[model samples]
Target: MFDLRMWFRALQIIPRLSKDEWDRLDLVSRWLIATRAAVFVMTIVSAGIGGILAARDGHFSGLNFLACLIGLVFAHATNNLVNDLTDHLQGVDEGNYFRAQYGPQPLEHGLMSVRDVLRYTAITGAIALAAGVWLVAATGTAALGLMLAGVVFVLFYTWPLKHIGLGEPTVLLVWGPLMVGGTYLCTAGQWSWDAALIGTAYALGPTAVLFGKHTDKLPADRAKGIFTLPVLLGEPLARRCVTVMLVLQLLAVVTLVWRGALGWPLLVVLAALPLLRDTAAVFARPRPETCPPGFPKHIWPTYLVAYAFRYNRRFGLLFLLGLLIDLALR
Candidate 1:
């Protein structure tokens, strides 16, 4: 029987499951949990921003935009699968490491085999690659270049990039200029610096989330030789960095509005200011040594990342909403 409830639950949060619980899940539920689909909204918001900008410019293609959206989501899914595979191979997620603590590390948890993960990666990556090929055929070499860049990042992000402190910066570039700007080019039939600028602002949200996650796991990563940005920078500096990035996200939008690249309607992103303030306050303090009183127990091990994810989702949605309003006014 199909378990719609588990499907929704998996999409909402990375549900922790025992092997028996995992065995009962439907395929889609398992995939959703495995890939961390809750975060896929970030990609959707990026693509939506790009498509809306294209429509605002009077150059939108519904078909191309649809393809771009699908392609980006699948590519993200592929990246997640590869991230797990790489970390498993590296022994990074072993010994109840931070990653395996928060969610089911299908491999580390003994729920899935190496072969199982590779098969998932192959199918997901193939779909993403197929979409990219179709897009390149439709949009030409520029699109091809963007597609290749994405592939490179996907292949190497978890290994040297995440391990060497380059991971946070990579997320900024991929989510911002690459994903959002590339989506615009494919759908609008041209490049736009303005769209890229907006993307950079939006990209800060995800970057902050990654920063927070890294910060939360800094001790474990340091012990395990992961050397993520947080490990390299230390917790205090990394926490401060996340706060700054969140503030910069707001400023970037203001700059775009000031330059008239975007209209005043885009100021609607200001609605997320309260979230910014809340996230900033959390980042202002060090992560608690243990799950604080009243905090959700299942999400205990992930403190800063949870707050960052909440703020990012709010900011991303509001940014998209602002774009929609800007389009309506135009």
Candidate 2:
């Protein structure tokens, strides 16, 4: 296997992981102690969405969930290493010590050698690609295409492709729909509107991530000549766009209802009250409280709202608990 060969190679570097390079591992952030949790949450959300869709059809595909989860973790972790390396190469992440210390960027702070980043990316990416191929072979060719597109998106987003004003959308579209769709297909064994509607909840998660990150890094972005959505769209237009996005999200549920994609059993999924409230909070601030208002920028995705909307895996627990109650009371 690709992984076994790498471990054998590490044997050649037996003394490499010595105390001299202990600081090298500082590249990955340890502040939250929950990087794996984030990955797990995403995997579960993927499987959960698949499960809900399968439930709609009166059948379930557990093997597909497992296969998709495995493939997703490998791909997500590979994307992390790629992003870390690309950010370091582009000068966008070198000085951001907090990002290096707290985010998964091991290369920025020398936590892992540049060699480590490269080696791990190759090994991990190969593993992800292999898993994806295996899933596609057993399931359908569509899964393979999804995985391939994912890699292309991540590569372009972190490197040459991210240089434009469109990085934010590409990131979300990659993180949200691609992952959701691929994972759903692994389980459902086919595509349907139910899967898309289920995936739609998760699709919002990445926007929250991008907006949250943008709010925090507006200064860094402007300094670096990065024209994010807020920067390109301007404050008023940006806020208006976000409002419309929220309204459209609500309308999706209605449209789904009309199309019978959503059964009445889960009709109450309509009550994402916090999402609505947070959308309003974004409109409350015209500009970053820390930055002056007249500048060509605004800060709507405040940390308060960002963290609030973050796709916490624990939310999956609440979702499962709610499902249990619904089943028990029924």
Candidate 3:
């Protein structure tokens, strides 16, 4: 049966689906889990921020906005599929890899065959490409160029980028300027440096999430010669880097408001400061080898990333709300 509740749960948390449950799940559910749909909200928020900025500037197009949103989300899904496939094929997830410890790795866990996963990737990439083509036809060369950039990131991000020390910075760029600014161009039919700047602020959240995940898997990555940012920086400095990025996120907003790019309404994101404070505290310290007291046992190995995602979700929603109010008043 198609369980809407289960589907929603998967979108919120990476549920550890049993083998029986995986078999019983509907195709949509399987696809959602395989794509790590829980994190899709970040891309949606990035796209929404872009569209809202375009609307405030009197250049929003509903059709183009929808196209950008779908295209980005599908591209993200395709990227996730590609990441899993690359890791599985490389034997990176073969033994006690951190990836399989926290959530299901379809191939590693025997939940899906290689061919089935590739089929999923193909369908998802096709949808994203179709949306990109539509936007390029409707908008212009700018949209085409942005789409090409996104494709490059999608294809190379897992292989050489993540394998090197460029994965974290790639997340920062892709989630920030590339996603938000590109969406603005798709809808507004023009580029805005302001959109790119604002997107950088929100991009910190996802960037921090990736940092945390990489830090969590730093040992595994080092052992396997992955050379992620965390592996390159080492655990202590990497943790400090995440804290610095979070502080920069707030500073970016404050600068925008001061320079008149954003309104005082954007100060409402300060509501997330307390959460950010707690998250910073966590990031300031090394992740515990065992589940800390009161931490959910099921999510033992996923400490920092979970906290980062929670802060990101709250900060993103508040940022969006602030933008909406600012737009309404103007």
Model 2 clashing residue pairs (backbone): 24-110, 24-111, 24-112, 25-111, 26-111, 27-105, 27-106
TM-score of each: 0.98, 0.73, 0.99
What local lDDT does model 3 show for residue 53?
Answer: 98
Best-performing candidate as measured by lDDT = 3
Q: Predictions ranked by TM-score, top down?
A: 3, 1, 2
The Cα local distance difference test for each model comes to 0.91, 0.56, 0.93
lDDT per residue as tens, model 2, 32-137: 1112224345455655656655654655577766767776776766766676677777778767532442333545545567776788778767877787787888
Is candidate 2 or 3 superior in lDDT?
3
* Model 3: per-residue Cα lDDT at residue 198: 92
Q: What is the lDDT of residue 322 in candidate 1?
A: 88
Per-residue accuracy of model 3 over 244-315 as CA lDDT, tens digit each: 888899888988999999999999988999999999999888889889999998886999888888988998
lDDT of residue 139 for candidate 1? 92
Model 1 stretches astray by more than 4 angstroms = none
